[model samples]
Target chain A: MSTTKKAHTTPPYELIYWPTIPGRGEFIRLVFEATGTPYTDIANETKDGISAVLALKDETATTSGDGNPPAFAPPALKIPGQGKDGKALVIYQTPSILAYLGNKLNFAGTDEAEKHYILSHTLTALDLNNETHDTHHPIASQLYYEDQKPEALRKATDFRESRLPKFFGFFERVLKGNEEGGGKFLVGGKLSYADTTLWHVLDGLKFAFPKELAAREKEFPALFGSFYGSVKEVSGLKEYLASDRRLQYSQGVFRYYPELDRQ
Target chain B: MSTTKKAHTTPPYELIYWPTIPGRGEFIRLVFEATGTPYTDIANETKDGISAVLALKDETATTSGDGNPPAFAPPALKIPGQGKDGKALVIYQTPSILAYLGNKLNFAGTDEAEKHYILSHTLTALDLNNETHDTHHPIASQLYYEDQKPEALRKATDFRESRLPKFFGFFERVLKGNEEGGGKFLVGGKLSYADTTLWHVLDGLKFAFPKELAAREKEFPALFGSFYGSVKEVSGLKEYLASDRRLQYSQGVFRYYPELDRQ
Candidate 1:
């Protein structure tokens, strides 16, 4: 058991999330890929690996074992030999995982203040990510898109006209304010998880609403022109994004419905 | 400036948020009150302190100054002498602020694993809080509830019948799994921001959907019977919750709209 973990820094850092669609899992996966950190994407890599993801939020299970409480949702990270008694430490929630990994992987900034700013920005990006999900499923996540078409249309329209501009304008200001970032980073000069997290949401947005994004792309020059383009070219991200490891967007947090786009 | 800050820890921890109504600001307030930490609620206390809150997300401004980037929203924390070159460090996002204060306030769990669990659970509780807000405004936040009444009814129905049960069950199992927690704490043997955060959301749910929460309260005994009731009696929370400092819910995240509540 110890031997397997030693090959990758003595801890098998495993990602447990739904198979396929990038969803929130991509936010966690991006950090590991960008830092060249070795990890296992349980659902995508192994047969029946999705059981691990299911178990994290199993309604009947009181705990996910190893003295860990049951997770409320997935995109949980399992690190062997990291728990209270060298057991696997499992943590769920995208932003929490990103903060933990970001700090450890050096993507969180140098100082304490920068670390939090990175988290603050990462959370805002995730908030936009969640709003994108709500664009198609405004009424309920369990219900089909057809059942909530009218609500989705109204929600998506408001999202495009009002919410997008509000979020985009705020992020643009963040990019423009940081003189050291040169319009690329949201926080300090170097790359942070906040950058990767925001970049993925933008990527998902482009896939989910190309027409709307294209029409509004030029509105926020710093966000679209520099910050969006620059993150893709970052060392490990450049390669992982091009690889098969980067899954396509479909039926997850982001979905491409022509009607939901800028018609 | 130094003299004023010196009285409260040499770095006046100021909470910049809208005056009146708890909204998301209550979550930040609970931590300060829980830990007996000295801080200022800028908008509620000071004359025209709301200008500082307004300036946080100023649409025309590129930055919030003192080297901080433009905040995406309010509930921002301003700490003097905590930024680069003693220029004041400001950060926004509810969970981010909670995580920072949770760690410092001794409300977050002791170890690395417990800390993340507390944060993960806090995020989930905040998710529920956000969902409660959506029950009253499903189509769009900017639109009045009357304009979106039809959709809010549908969303509120799903929230009561489905969403509430799922969240409640998850927290119940978390309390059951931790023997040391004894049904009161969500993580370790002590109370966490996760507990307080979840308590507030439940309190809001009671105010917002009295019938729904009342009918479903007994379904999760450990959560409602123990955890929910236990937190309010805790040291700081007991005193804080009983005082006028504990604001009532009105036109905020947990608004009491009988139409949106269960029949």
Candidate 2:
């Protein structure tokens, strides 16, 4: 309803994500920030914005539903427009939400080939996201991070050495492939969600394994440079970072566990 | 290229997966089977089908071309007649490929909501798949299952006790929500990719942890039953499972490490 209640209605999307952690929602939030689109971020909705999400979930938890339920999980998006029966429209899953937004925002590749390219890249970044989360919580998410600290140490070290290099290598290839656009962004002539995601991934790694990232930063100069430079320069992203909305890396997906960061 | 040669090309898509080892590709292979689509098993490309996978990775690693790189590690799809510039289309990442095929085959949901719902469920199955893989390769994918036996045992114990119940519980809720279609499918009135994925997840778990699965099977009777019933009745899957293309569980993502499986 925040998206609907707003006076200036250029953007009409409601995002329901955990207020305490940026986690998955940061990807979608970055896209909106980059595009300068207005979307209501219902952070920590239990006190404020979660009621809508809970209601939506309860309504769809049945068989006789008229429409499709969100496939699963958080980072759901809702367009305030009404349906045939005059209700809201919603979609979930970060990839699906990004795809829908890419389609809406025109960053999702212009042609079929481009769409495929965007989709493929999006999925690739998603893999990195999952792996990043698994680095700390490799054993289980329900269990506390402390409970799995030993496994986390081994996993994080491997992630810093093997996984980081591999991912940085992949993104470096993507950046190098951008020869069509003077070799700046990942796709086309301008920035896409892929670029934003790369920035997030790099930022997360830097926070989690600052020493490793600092040591290995020179290896992926192109990707690392573009990531650092873009985050600093992107006006909206700069603002988001400076603002309180961008949650600090704490107990979220990518945590800075010094013990786990050792070589 | 095989798809191009099809005369009565109504034959389903061409799935290029390892001839041996169910691995990640089985997710897509199962859907094609469930939907009764005709697809060629390119398992014979190499001496034992794994070389073919290696060749694909080689292309991913060394090949430099224009367009986004392949997503995820494996289980790429070659859709017939949809390739760009007369080339056979290739899409990677098991979940994305399954969702793409599900959409094309009409096994995905009817609308956006249904599509998200199916994706979420499939993703949870994928999470389960990841845990199964970690049971064998806990330290790193670069290390062989045998090399990581000690780590695998530690990881698997936690997986069986904690992770299994979480994923299984999610599936149970999904199945229980099937009030219109009975508690047999994961989504909507008909079978979706989630159901097939659930089948494969349960099947792989049963194969890898027969003793553990058998002990807990009765506790999740509906989920266990849905796994068997869905795959048995699925059209092409039944044929595929019986054929040579259906690889064994050895050396794949989900391996039978007895030490890890034992209580």
Off by over 4 Å in 1: A1-10, B1-10
Model 1 chain A scores worst on lDDT over the 10 consecutive residues at A1-10
Model 1, TM vs. native: 0.97
Local accuracy of candidate 2 as per-residue lDDT tens digits, A22-51: 788899988887777778887554366866
Candidate 1 lDDT tens digits, B1-263: 11332255534689999888998999999988777777889899899998998888689777777988878898999888788898988988999999988877677989999999999999999999999899989988899999999999999999999999999999999999999989999999998889889999999999999999899998999999989899999987898888988898899999988988889
List runs of model 2 lying over 4 Å from the truth: A1-11, A50-72, A80-86, B1-14, B43-52, B59-72, B79-84
Predicted complexes: DockQ each? 0.86, 0.33
What docking grade applies to model 2?
acceptable
What lDDT does candidate 2 reach at residue A125? 80
* Model 1, span A1-263: residue lDDT tens: 11333355635689999999898899999988778778889999999998888777679998888888888888888888888898888889999999989877788988998999999999999999999999999999999999999999999999999999999998988888888999988888899999999999998999999999999999999999999999999987898888898998889998999999999
**Per-residue alpha-carbon lDDT of model 2 for B171-233, expressed as tens digits?**
665667656557777666777887888787888888889888988877776688755676566
